[model samples]
Every structure is written in structure tokens, then in C-alpha cells.
Target: MIVVALRARSSWHKPAWWATAFGAIAVATYGILWATPVVLDGMLGGRNLLTLVRDAAAVAAVWFFHNAVAAQQRKPEKKLPAWGLGLAVLSFTVPFLLISRPGPTSSAFVLDRLDQFPVWLFSSIYIFIVGALAARAIALLSSEKTVMTRFYVLGLSLMLVGSIIELMYLAATHFGPTNPDFRESLYYVAERPFFGGIFITVLGFLWVYAVRVFWKHLARWTLRIDARHEGGEYLARSLATSSENGWSDRQLAVNSAVNIRDRLKIGTQALSRREHALFSGVEHLLSNHLERTPR
Candidate 1:
């Protein structure tokens, strides 16, 4: 979390920080709803309000995560329409208004008495959110070579799996009564996997933050360049490779010279030393190139 805050100084990490913040808020809201004992007309108002807030915040978290990662892509990323966002928020009300009573109900009643429409609506929104997160994570995993990007992918993947489990369990509670044995077993085992997923997600975020904060400094200190006697092109290529592989500094110094040596191993091929020096002085080409890289 501290790392996220620190990284927020850069434009690239701002959205990521916001995503985390919103996620935290959603979690807190859920905790409040579960623990509080306030009674509001014994029905739809308080519980529904809390649920809506949680859902809205969750949606914002996913949207921000997608936005941050997508900004790094070369091509524009797919976006949810504004109306689509509104619809997602609206779905939270369906369960409160139709499927669920203001107070708690028995598992049997929830399954047999309530309609499945609201349950499916709730599940679909969660699936869509997690699906979007998974897709973005996959894209980043495939394209970005950085180790930290993998951690980001891992975190999103964990959340996706966890969400699916929770959704399935919820569905089962509603429908599992059709088979009494299945319902009982599912009730016992359903929540365990969900927490495991949450644990992994937290760990993954820690790994991602570590890379974001320390990887650059570590690379800068550990990298050993042997281009001391090499030609300008050789040095440039080496630095370019390092930068592409996330082994170079965000800000680098580049220098070229007038009387630079342009000899090959054979000490042959003469070229304009000034031009070579100019190119050499330019910072690692990869640094320049990365301006366009979604990383």
C-alpha cells in the first residue's frame, strides 16, 4: 500500500493506486454491513444501500484497474459504455427488491421461494467485472516482459477465481435445495476456497509493489555493461535490450563524441565519429521507445 502511494507520484501508477483505494473501501463497506446492528424499517433500505455502495465501489475498482493497465497498450483498449456501467449498478437492487426479503431467510426459503432472475443478474455483473480484469491481465502478461506485470496478472487471476467461487456458492444456495445432499455439502465447503483466493490476491499485490519500487534500483546497481571499448551501435543495442527487458532506469543519461572509435574487431570500417557520438549520447533508445510501450 505504501508502495502504491509512492508510485502514485507518477501518472502511470495513479490509476492503480485509485483502484486499490476503491477496493479497500468496498471491503470496508461490506464489513460494516455485516457487523452493524442498526435497524431501518426492518427491510430494504439499509441493507440495500450498503450492497449498492459496495457494488459501485467494486465497479470503480475494476474500471480503474483496467484503465491503468490499458493506458499502457499501443492500441486503444475496449471500454464499457456509460449506460452499461449504470446497468451494472442498477442490478444490485434486483436482489433486494425481488429475490431477497429485508430480513434474513432460511436457505430453503431463499432457494424455493425467491426467483432466480435476481440471482443471475447479480452473478452476471460479478462475472463481467472479473472477466474484464482477467482479460486485461492476460494482455499484460502476454505483451509486457516485466516480472512485476506477472504479479499483477496473478493478483487479478486470483480475484477472478475467488469471485467465480463465491458466485457459484451463491447460486447453489438458491438452487442447491433441489438436491438436499448437495446443498449441505456445498454450504460446508463453499467459503473455504473463496478466502484462499483472497489470500493469494493480497500476496500477489505485494509482489507487484515490490517490483514497482525496487526492481529499477536493483537493475541499475547490478547491471554490468561491457561496452567500454565497443562501437556506438554495439553499446546502443546492449542498452536497448536492457531497457526492453526492464533492466534499465526510467531516466538515463546518453552521450556521444566527435573522435569516437568506429573500428570493428578487425579495426576496419571507418565512420563519422561525431554522428556515432551523437547517437551514443542519446539515452538508451528503449527508454525513448518505452514512451509508447504500455508498460
Candidate 2:
């Protein structure tokens, strides 16, 4: 996230900035988890409201990630209006708040409240939003044939699959027997894909960034070599075409030829065989011109 934030400093309007925002929200979502139920329950008055906040942050992160992909592909960034997102939050929050969640918050709030319809509604809503966005991202990324896009698609596909598994788990928990061991096992199974997806997606983005940095440096180096080649050729031609007649003119031509030679020598490795032959011909021309010049 820090790396993306620094990259965003200059390109705040670009896709990288959107990616940085996504990273921040993702970190916050996990940070909520890392804080643990005990700390969050204490902080939020024991209602597990932090779980709602975490889900909301996760949704926002997915939205930003979708925007980043869209921007990278030069597609229109289709945003759910602020009101719509708020409504989505309210849909789950109102029901979750209305439900009676007695005692201190559990580490697995959803699993603990699996008997409640409100919990089901909350989990369903979250899964639907994430799944819908992941599906959209997959569709968007599929059109592009680049390696970067492929990785993005693969990561999103994994996430979409994870969301599907969560949906299944939600249904099973709501309808089937609430065996703690089975529920916990299935929950972890649903979670694995999300972790895998996050890892793969981050890796893909890093790979693309590294490749871009390499190519950018290579381009600059190539430009410098080309500049040297052009400078050498220009100076050589000018010296060979000189019509001035004096010892000073001869001396000046000698100096210019020497400068051109130095440039050619510096960029010798970058020069092609044809370019080498061309410079050799120019050197011969300079020698002839020097011999003809009046002392």
C-alpha cells in the first residue's frame, strides 16, 4: 500500500491512484479483523458494529479495484452512485442492528448468528456485491489479451469462485444443521480462495509495475544512444562539407572530427553494422577533406 501510495503521488488521476485507494481500504478491512472481536466489541459498545464497518470497507475496496481495472483498460468507470452504495449498506445494517445479538462479540460473528435471518441477509448482501463486482471485473479484463490482464482475470475469477462458495456456505448454514466443526471447516474453505485471489492479484500488479519500470529505463538508454549516434553523424558530415581555407579551419575540422569519433566510440556497442559502415565512410570523407584543406 505504501508503494502504491507513493506511485499515486504523481499520477493521482490515473488508475494507479485508484489501485492505491483499493489497497488502503483492503488494509483497513483486514485491520479490523486483526483488531479482533474483543477489542472491536469493546470499542463499538459490544454490538459487533465493526463487522458491518469491515464489510462496508471490503465492498468499497472491490469497487475501487474495479475502477482501477476499468481505467487501465480505457473503459468508462461505471460507479454505483453514493446513494446506491449507502442503500446497500443500510439494507444489511438496518437488519443487523434490528437483530438481537446478545453477549460479547464472537470472533466468528456470522457463524455464531447463523440461526438468525438478519445475519443471513447481511452475509448475502455482502457476497452479492463482491460477487457482482468480481464478475464485472472478470468480463472487463477478459477482453484484453495482455499478460497483465490475464493475471487480473485469473485473480478475479478466484475471488468470484470464493464468493460463490461463501454463498453456498451461507445457504447451508441457514438451512442445514449448525454443526460447529463442519461450519468452521466450510468457512475456512470459503476464505482460502479470497486469500489466494488477493495474493495473485497483488503479484500480478507488481509484475506489471516491474516490467514497466524496466522498459522505461531501457527506452531512456536507447534514446541517449540514438542521440549520440545522430550527433556523431551530424558533426562528421559538417566537418566533411567545410569549404573554409586556413590553418584555423583545418584545426577546427580536426577538433570536430575528433569529437565525432569520441561519440561514435562511446556508443559503439549500440551501433548497428550498417551504422558502423556509414561512420567508417564518414571518417574516410573527413580524412580526404583534411588532406585537401590549405595549411
Candidate 3:
């Protein structure tokens, strides 16, 4: 996640970097927030305000990554729906009002039942979108060769697996056996897989997103530098050949210098000032060598 943030800081223009950074941060933030929710709950004067915030952050992360992946495919950027954004906002801003319960069920159960709407809606949208995106990435893996593509596929796959496990936990709690013993057993059984999957999924995504952003520019820089070196080599060869022939062929020397100059310009702009100075030195040497030759 730190790597992704640094990459994004360097390349703000690329949509993928921004999206991946946001997604990585969102996951990390949620993990941190969830760790000491009780303290936050006390600080905020609420039982689960942080939980609601966490849900919204998760949804936002998914939305951002969807945009990132779509941008990578050269697809037209789709505007995010206002309603979805509004729902996330509402999840956080909605008043945490409590209604008096008059039944065998405890007050906590009543509150939990009431809490279902916002959390379920957020979870459903997040799960569905992530699942769809994962499938799309898998389909794309057959043809795309970029490092980003492979990592995206791997990251999405891990995320999908993690999401499925989480969904199973949610489903079991919401609709599975109601027996207290069964519920306790299920919770214990599901704990490791649920958290482990999330940890691995986020780790995979960090690699995918960070590599894509950094490697794209790194590869471009490498190619430019290599081409510049090759141009310099061509210039060196022209100077050597021109020098060896001496005054025997003045026209040939002139022609060789002109050829060297043209090739030297191929990627001259990519070089640093010091490298440019070196190129200029070579050019000067070539011209002087040609001039010294007798016509």
C-alpha cells in the first residue's frame, strides 16, 4: 500500500495509479478502523459509526478500482452514479436512532436488524461489482501481456475468493441455522478463512496496482535510454570510419558526418544535459575530423 501511494504520487495523471492507490488505502484504513472500534465507538458516542464508515470506504475502494480497470482497457470513462455515492454518504450521515423494543429479542438484536439495510446494500453492491470485475479480468488474461494485466487478474481473483468467503459468513449469520451452538461453531470455523482471504487479496492487489503504475513508466524510460545509447554507438562508428579513411576520400567523410548527425538526433532529447554534452563533443569531433580531411 505504501508503494502504491508513492507510485500514485509520482504519476497523478494516470487513472490506474489513482484508483489503485485509493483502493489500497481504503482497505488499509478499514483494517485499522476495525481493530479498535470500541474505542472509536466511545469517542464517537456510538456503537458502530466506524463500522458504517468502514463499509462506505470499502464501497468507494471498489468503485475506484472499477474505474481504474476500465481506464486501462481504453474504454470510455463512465461517470459514477450519484445515487450510489449518495447511499454511501447516507450510510454515514443517517441518524443512529433507537426504537424501543417490546419483544423476546434483545435490544442488540433489534438494533442489528435495523442496521441490516445499509450494511447489506453496501455489501451486496461491493460483492457484485468486484465479482464481475474479477471475471472480466480473467477473460482479459488470455490476450493482454502487460505486467499490469497479469497482476490485475491475480489480484482480482484473490479478492473474489476472499469476497466469497466473506459472503458465506454473512449468509450463515443472516440465514443459516439459528441454533446458538451451531452459530458459535460456524463463527469459529469461518474466522481464519475470512480474515486470511482478505489479507491475501489486498496483498495481491497492492502488488498488481503498484507494479502497473511503476513498471509502465520504468519500461518507457529504459527504452528511451537504450535508443539514445544505440544512437551514440552509431555516432562513434561514423567518427571512427571517417578518421580511418583520412584525406583519401573527403566526400565520403562529409557524407559519414552528415549520417552521424542525423542518427545522433534520433533520441538526443531523451538524454540528460551531461549526456547531451557528450553528444555535442562527439559531433564537434566528427565535424573537425571531416574538415581536417582534404577535399
Candidate 4:
């Protein structure tokens, strides 16, 4: 229980994972905020509100990748994680029936044109949209991929680009007949760009966020490597200094031996000179004694 709770808290710190989680949540939460514009009488504009939610969701999802992706692999596999992926895929299919298909045949209804689809169809569409986005939230936050984690950063980056393009198209088209030049426009084009772009460009934030998370992981490993290498080098230098000292000592001993040898030679020469002088004095005294005895 402690580990689970700790993991949950760490999840938000991951910028990429957070964005992704938020994006998924926004997709689901659209139901509650979708009609906010009608009751409040512009208390909160529809487009801006939806854009904010969507962008917020995207940011959350990005953070999820950062916090959980690396750690997810270590957890035990449960049946619930598989169910999540299925739900996410199902969500995508519902939009096909509710929103018009991209090519041509898919049925799509404008939000303003409520008469086009029955109430039941709208409800079904909402549920599916929520499921689809929620699935992404669950999949990214809960699952752990080993090889995929090793390589998927680039893939996720590409996926973000595709999502942004799709979101841009949706935002551009999901408009009412309100002209900005007239008083009918709830918000200016500039406002929509920031709001809508939140969903699309949240990916850019995710990219930087991904880099930051990975860098934190990379930094610790690098510091250890540096410390080990530095220590080894220092030890080697000490050994080299010791070797140089040994050479200096050897040179001093050789110089002392040469000085001792020179002193010994000078002492021997002085002793020989003293002996020669004593021998000459004794020979002169012996000759005088022999001459006096013969007389």
C-alpha cells in the first residue's frame, strides 16, 4: 500500500506522462464541461473550455510517461491493465460512428446541429469518447515496457505530432457560425489558437519533459562512473610519485659513498709520511753508538 501510494505521487512529476494523462482525462471529462457554455450563458465559452480541458489532459498524459514508464516494468502483472488497452481501442471506434469518418462515408454531426443525431446516439458517442481517452490514460500510467521503454521515446514523439495535426483539424472545424467581426464571436481567433493549440502543442512540452526525466536518470549513473574513474587515476599518480622518490634516495647514497672514499685516501697518505720521518731519525742514532764502542 505504501509503495502504491508513493508511485501515484511520483506519477505527476513526470512532465510527459502528466501531459498524456491529462490529455486522456480531458477526453473523458469533455462530457461534464462540453455543455458548460449553454447553462452559464457564456459563463465559460464552449470552445475555450473544451480546449483547456483537452490541453490539460495532454499535459497530464506526458507526465505519466515520465513518472511511471521507467518504474512500471517492475510491478506484477494484473488483469486490469489488459482491460485498459481494450477500452482505449474501443473508444476510438465509437467516434467513427458518431463523428464522420475522415475519408467520406463516416457519419459526423456538428455540435451546433443537435437535430442530426438522436439523443441516444449522442449519449453513446460521449461514452465511447470518454472510454477511448481514458484508455490511453490507463495504458500509459499503468503498463511497463522494457524494450519499448528503451526505444519508444522517439515513437511517442512521432505519435504526438500526428495527434497535434488531428487536433488542429478538429478545432478548426468544430466552430459555430459566429463571425469574429460581429459581436457573435465568444472569443477571438487568437484565443482559440491558444486554447486549441494547448492540446496540439502540449506535445512540444512533452518533448522537453521527456528529456528532463531521462537526464535525471542519466545523471546519477554518470556521477558514479566519474567517481570510479577519478579515484583510479589518483591512485596511479601516487604510485608514480613514490617511484620517483626511490630514485632520488639512490642518487644521494651514491654521492655519500664517493665522499667517504676520498677522505680514506687522504688519511692513508698522512700515516705513510709520519712513518718515513721516524725511521730516518732511528738510523742516525745507531751509527753514532757503533763508532764510540770501537775506539
Candidate 5:
């Protein structure tokens, strides 16, 4: 993420910038998780606000990822209207705030709060948004033939599948099972694909960025070589033009050989006996033709 951010520092509107944002926000979401909800909840006033923040960050990261993919495909950089985004945020925030979080901050927030309506509401909204964006990304990348696009599609497909599994698990927990162990097992099963998908997606982005940088440097090197050998290149082109303009096959071959020799700075003495003999004969023949040509 830091590398991407540095590379994208020049332009805020490029696809790289959006990709950087996606990476950063995704990292932050997990950073919160790694900090442990107990610590974060206490710092944020103990209403499990960290969970809400984590879910919000996850949604934002996915949204940024969708934008990155769209921009990479050369789509218009249209963002969701501010009002719509605000309303969506409010929808999630209101439910979370209204729900009672009476006990000490639980490490297993999702499993413990599965029975709460607000928890279900928050989870449903997050899953739905993530699923939709992942599906859109898959659809966008399906038409692209690049290796990076294939990786992107595969990653997004995994994410979409994970979202579907999580939704189903949520429903089962509500309607089918009340057992804590069963819910925990189901949660892990559903969570693995999402994290795997994220890993693969970030890898794809970094790989593609590195490839682009390599090609850019290669192009610069070729351009420098072209500039340095301008005279040799011009001579080669002139010889080709003469050959195309009704020069005899013998004349063309001799001229092309001479051009190669001069371009490589090969001296007559450097030629092998047979090669020296052939060039001498061709030069003599060319001289005779030049002498006979009308002045």
C-alpha cells in the first residue's frame, strides 16, 4: 500500500490512486480487527463502535476497489452522489446506535450478537454491498484478456462467493441453529474465502503495477538506443528504399551487406577470405555499372 501510494502521488484521479485507497482502507479495517475489539471499544466509548467502524471501513474499501476496476477499464469516474452516500451511512449507523450493547465488549461480537436485529441489519447491509460490488467487478473484468484481469476476476468471484456463504450462514443462524459452536464453525468457514480473496486481489494489483514500471523503463531504454544510432538507422532505411525502387537483386544484396558492415564498423581486413572475395567482386561489378550509366 505504501509503494502504491508513493507511485500514485502525482495524480489523485488515476486508477492507481483509487487502488491505493482500497489497499490502505482494507489494511485499516484489518488493523482494527488485530487491535482486538475489547481495546477499541473501550477507547470508542464501549458501545461496540469499533465494530461499526470496521464494517464501515470494509464497505468503503470495497467501494474504492470497484472504482479502481472501473477506472482501469476506462469507465467514467462517476462517484455516488454525496446525499446517497450519506443516506446509506445513516442507514447503517442508526441501527447500530439503536441496538443495546449492555455487557462488556465481547471478543466474539458477531457470534454473540447474532440474535440482535441491529446486528443482522448491519451485517446484511455490509454483505449486500460487498456482494454487489464484487459481482460488478467480475462482470467488468470478464471481457479483458490480460493476466491481471484474470486474477482480478478470480479474486472477485471468490469474494462474491464468500459473501453469499456469509448471507446464508446469517440466515441459518437466525432460523436454524442457536448453538454457539455451530455458529463459530460456520463463521470461520465463511470468513476464509473473503480474506483469501483480498490477498489475491492485492497481489494482482502489485504485480501489474510492477510490470507497468518495467515496461516504462524498457521503452525509455529503447528510445535512447534509437537516438544514439540515428545515423545507422537512416542508412538502413535508405538502402531499403533503393532496393524497393527496381534495384537489381545483386545490387540490393551488395548494398545491404555494405550497410550491415558499416553499421557494425567491420573493416575489410576483418572479413574472412571468402567474404572478402565476394565483396571485392560485387564492388567491381557495381563500379562498372556506375561507369556505364548516363551522366
Candidate 6:
């Protein structure tokens, strides 16, 4: 007699990434749908509203690792994760300060672009930086032995390159148009290649290398493991929209400190004492409930 055994699902095989991807798409969608209303308009304080969403995505990425993305039996990092998340939440305020207050002096440095581009552009960067840092933390979990590889280092490097571009753009308005020759070269570089240009190109190659090596292992989880379980099969269903609905509450729970995102995504217009207390209360409740759930 031949028999088929239904395998009991492991905790790691759950729909966490699906939820993470969902939240990412929802924000990206919010950004796209409201691009004109929130991103392009600074007259009615829409820019700050957009900043809220950007920061929330950052906080969400941080929380994802904290709550859903970690390995089974693995511990989260203590320091770098905090730093990554802090910068992500803090990055939201950069635009508000640039746009708020009296005169052009509030944007004392090269942050003029805060006024020029929609907040979503920079917010996208903030989210990516947060994700990169979080990925580095995940990679570092195995950094002690031979498994400690180039992926973490590469992620750090990409985050630095993107950060430098952001900082330089803030410092000078002519960053992209520095010189006709440089613009032509860089523009062409960005068009054909993913990262493009000299430094970014180098980092791009490194990112690919890191992705190749690290994802070779991660693909086991992303693909090979999917072959083994129903939940994994669910996760594999959408490359664009993973089970985003799965871990959203988890995202919010870990990022309760990241009020910037909480405000924007939830569209909290003003945080009076009552609203603040309510949000605080809700976050506290969620945190407790999250601690109990298996996901």
C-alpha cells in the first residue's frame, strides 16, 4: 500500500513575506494614487503627509525583521537594527523641517529638493535604506562563522552610496546637473545599467554579487522551500505582491515607536492629546497581542 503523509507546517513556512510585500505595495500604491495630492502639493501641508508614509515604510521594514522576517531560533540584532530603524523614522522629519518654519533658512543646506520633488521620491530612498540595513542585520545573524559573507557588507555599501547621493543632493542643487559632461555620462549610465555611473556602478556590481551569493541560499527559502509547503506555496504566488496582508499588524506592532509612519498611513491629521493617547493605547494593545501570536 502506498500512502501520502501531509507534512505539518513549520513556523518559518508561514505567510510573513506575503504580508510584508502587501504593506509595501499598499504604501507604494498610496504614493502613486496620491502622488499629486500628497507629493506634489506643499501648499496645504500635503508634503508632510507624504513624509509620514515614507517614514512608515521605513519603520515597517524595520519591524518586519523584528517580527516576521527573522529565522527560526535566530535572535534579532540589538544595535544596528535600532540605528537603521531610527534613521528611517528620522528621515521623515528631514522633509518636514525643510518645508516647515520661516523662510528659506529652514532648508539651510542643500535640501532645496525637498521643495522641488515630491516627498515620495526621498521617502522611497528612506524605505530602501531601511530595508538594506535590515537585510544586513539578517545577514549578520550568521556572520560569526564561515556563513558570514559579503551580502551584509554589500548592503551596507549600497545604503552608503544612496545616502551619499541623498546628502549631496541636499547640499547642492546642481547635483544631477553638475556638469553637462557628467550629466550626459551619468544619465546614460542610469538608463542602460541598473545603478549606472562610476561609484554606483561599482556598488551595483557588488549588490548583484551579494544578491547572487546570499539569494542562492535565500532562494532555498524563496523557491525550494516553497516546493515543500502550502504556506510557502502561498508566498511564492506573487512576485509583485507577496502576502502583504499576512504581517501588517506585526509591522505596526514592532514600529509603534515609529509614529511618523503610523500618522501618515493612518492619515492622522493632528495628534492632539486624545489622539496621541489613543494611538499609544492602540499600539500597546497590539504589541501585547503580537507577542502572543505565532506569526
Per-model TM values vs. the true structure? 0.53, 0.65, 0.51, 0.27, 0.67, 0.35
Model 6 error, position 10 (Å): 12
Model 6 misplaced regions, further than 4 Å: 1-27, 30-48, 66-73, 76-91, 94-157, 172-295
Q: lDDT tens digits, residues 11-97, model 3?
A: 666655655565555555334545554554445555444554555555555555565555556554453453765665454444322
TM-score-wise, the better of 4 and 6 is: 6
| Residue-by-residue lDDT tens digits, candidate 6, 133-194 | 54554454454432223443444345445445544443333434464455345433322321
Q: What lDDT tens digits, residue by residue, belong to model 1 across residues 1-295?
A: 3444565667434666777777776766534554542332124344344555566777776766676566546344554445766666676655545655534422233334334667556655655565566666566566786776666666666666666765676665665554656655664464454445445655665565565555454333222222444545765675687567754343322111211222322344333466334334332343443221111
Over 1-295, each residue of candidate 5 has an lDDT whose tens digit, in order, gives: 5665676656666645655665575466444545655676787776667677766666666666676677666775543433654566677777777676634666577678879887777777778777887897787778888887888888888889998999998888866856888998989999889778877887887787676675444333323332334555654564457557955444454444444335435332244466446545544555643322111
lDDT of 4 at 18: 43
**Can you write out model 4's per-residue Cα lDDT over 1-295, one digit (the tens) per residue?**
2322444576644433444555556655444455432332234432233333343344335334433443444333322343553454344344334533222111122223322233224333333333334334345543444443323433443343334433433344343333323322422332343344344434544554565555444333322322333465643453355357743322322322233223334542122354334323322333332221110
Please report how far candidate 3 places residue 282 from its true position, in Å: 23
TM-score attained by model 3: 0.51
Better of 1 and 6 by TM-score: 1
Residue 103 of model 4 has an lDDT of 23
Alpha carbon deviation, residue 9, candidate 3 (Å): 5.7
Q: After superposition, which runs of candidate 3 have C-alpha atoms over 4 Å from their true positions? A: 1-21, 24-36, 77-83, 88-151, 161-172, 175-177, 188-201, 209-295
Q: Higher-TM-score candidate among 2 and 3?
A: 2
Q: For residue 211, what is the lDDT in candidate 6?
A: 50
A best-first ranking of the candidates according to their lDDT comes to 2, 5, 1, 3, 6, 4
Residue 159 Cα positional deviation in candidate 6, in Å, after optimal superposition: 3.6
The full ranking of all candidates by TM-score, starting with the best, is 5, 2, 1, 3, 6, 4
| Lowest lDDT block of 10, candidate 6 | 1-10
**Worst 10-residue stretch by lDDT in candidate 2?**
241-250
**Where in model 5 is the C-alpha error above 4 Å?**
32-42, 77-87, 102-106, 217-295
Q: lDDT per residue, candidate 2, 50-96, as tens digits?
A: 67776776676677677777766667746434576677667777777
